[model samples]
Target: MKVAIYTLGCKVNQYETQAMEQELRRRGHQVVAFEEAADVYVVNSCSVTAVSDRKSRQMLYRVRREHPQAVLALCGCYSQTHPEDVEKLDVDLIAGTGDRSGFLDLLEQAAAERRHIVALDRSFDHRTFEVLPAGGLESRTRCLLKVEDGCVNFCSYCIIPYARGPVRSLPLDKAAEQAAGLKAAGYREIVLTGIEISSWGQDLKDGKSLIDLLETVAAAAPGVRLRLGSLEPRTVTEDFCRRAAALPDLCPQFHLSLQSGCDETLRRMNRKYDTARYLQSVELLNRFFDRPAVTTDLITGFPEETEAEFEQTLAFIRACGFARMHIFPYSIRPGTPAAKMRQVPKSVKEERAHRAAAVAAELRKNYLEGCVGATYPVLFEQPKEDWFFGHAPNYAEVLVKGTDLHNEIRPVTITSTDGEFLYGTIKE
Candidate 1:
């Protein structure tokens, strides 16, 4: 059978989809592009918000409409949380967030019998971590190694805690082995990604933490650069910074998750940390890594958030000086606690999003401009038109007019900026 996999949501989802593709290929099935004619269409869905759910439905329906003969497989967060909704879709196989191997088995069975199958587990009931292989089909500059799974942080606005279960980690030795294997496979960079990487060693009694995972992975990949996924603000401690800084391969970009900056809004959102704690984490990253690019996520117009509170958020983000920030207007998810609170007006959410976006743009531009005159070891990913696009250690996009720079790390000296990316020249 020919399989076409479409993934939605975070890097973990992408990694899992790649794992699925690998599994199918191992079973002697062809893995084709989604646009190509195929026997199966697997939509690894996301349900971060109402918008995400709608998008997941739209993608699945489009596949069903376009290729009626192909089997439709709906899985991931959307199918995990709202199985009934997914069952209503013209899907042949319905699998939840876990049980990838079982999902593949069911997919084969569904293909053979042309019958519908539902494979969902009580997400939180299973404490054992599901191990899936990392890396993908094509040889790429960066690969995501999911070292952790699930989140315990039941934030007011998130459905992920339910969609993904309690914290389960890939043990330290296993993580090191995976990293070594990915490095052996010729991947230049390995991104340690997960639902909540900060909560990584909580389920284990080995006294290992996120830093231990980082250090272990770093040591595993002798020459490969290591990048981290989004981190909870609470994870960036002085100890973490101090230890992580010593690892030469770790990238300097840190994405701290800060939904809303205002203390009152944070309390309402049930965030574990306030602006002060978030700032402390940001400061520690800066203190340890030289000119580290600190990025963050922000939600505007949260439930019952006053304009003054929004302003406080704006002021707090400006103070953080994030290199890049993703700001989204609040979207209510049905099962989350924030959805039950007095909702903020859509107009207010839109307005605040725009305002915050403007500030974020300015900060981004400044960060790019600040890169001028700096020489960085950039891992060149691909070349397009007149330039080869790559990323510096801080995850800054560095573009150079060059030929065949793919998968090559070169010394790039940033000489100019176009307000979006830094144009640089590769030093011979």
Candidate 2:
């Protein structure tokens, strides 16, 4: 059989799609491009927001229209949360978030028997972590290793917890083994990804923390740089900062998840930390690493968010001085508690988002300017017009005129800044 996969949403979904492709190939099936004729088309969906859900539906419709004879298989968060909606579509196979191996078996069976298959388990029913391949289809230089899955925080605006169930972690020994394997396979970097990686090792009986897991993996992959996924503020203690800074191979870029900047709004959102705690986390990272890139996600207009609250958020973020930011307007999802509350007007949401974006742009320019005359090690990914583009250890984009820089990490001395990226030449 020929298989084609279309993935939407987070890195975890991408990782799963790659795993499915690997399994299909292992079973003597061919994986092809989505545009070409294929025996099966898989849609790895996301349901982080209503927009993601709509996009998932749109992709499904497009696939069915283009390849009417191909068997359509649906999996991931969207189908896990709204299986009924997916069932109404003309899909031949249906699956929830977990069970990739089983889902692949069903897809193969459906192709052979010419029948429909619906196999979905309850979210919380899963107890063990399903190990899958780590490398992605795009690049062999960087891979995402998912050591943890699921979130128990139950943030009001998120539907992931219910879709992914309780926390299931890969054992520390297994994680170390995987890191070693990735290093042996010629990957220069590995991103530790999960639904909430900060909550790793919570379900274990040995009482090891995320820091312990990090230590194990870092030690195993001494040659490759280990980049972390989004982290909760609570994980930013003095000890975590000190220990993480001591590791020579760990990347100095941190993405701390922050939805709102006001205390009352955070309370309504059921966030465990206040503005003060979040600021503490930011300060800790800055103190530990030399000009580390601190990135974040911010939602502008949450339910019942007043003008004063939004102002407070704006001021708070400015105080943090984030190096990189992604600002978004809130959207309603039917199953989340946030959907039932009084929503701010869409115009107001967009307005705040624009304002936040302007501030974000200014901060990014300032960060880039600070990078002038600095030397960094950059791993080139690809080439473009008159230059090869790559990212520094701090996750800053660096463009230099060069050839054959792919997969090679070289010293780059940044000479100038274009307000968006640092222009540099490789140090011979």
lDDT of each: 0.91, 0.91
Which stretches of candidate 1 lie above 4 Å from their native place?
none
Query: lDDT of candidate 1?
Result: 0.91
Q: Model 2 over residues 124-224: C-alpha lDDT tens digits?
A: 89788998877755456788998999999999999999899999998988999988988888889999999999999888868888889999999999979
- Residue-level lDDT for 16 in candidate 2: 85
lDDT of 1 by residue, 1-428 (tens): 99999989999999999999989989999999999999999999999998899999999889989999999998999999998888888899998988899999999999999998888888898698888988995568899999889998899999998999999999988998999999999999999999999999999978889999999898889789999999999999899999999999999999999989899989988889888999999889888999999998999989999989888988898899999999999999999999999998899899999999999999999888889999999999987678899999999988999888899999999999887888988888
In angstroms, what RMSD does candidate 2 have relative to the true structure? 1.0
What is the alpha-carbon lDDT of model 2 when measured against the actual structure? Answer: 0.91
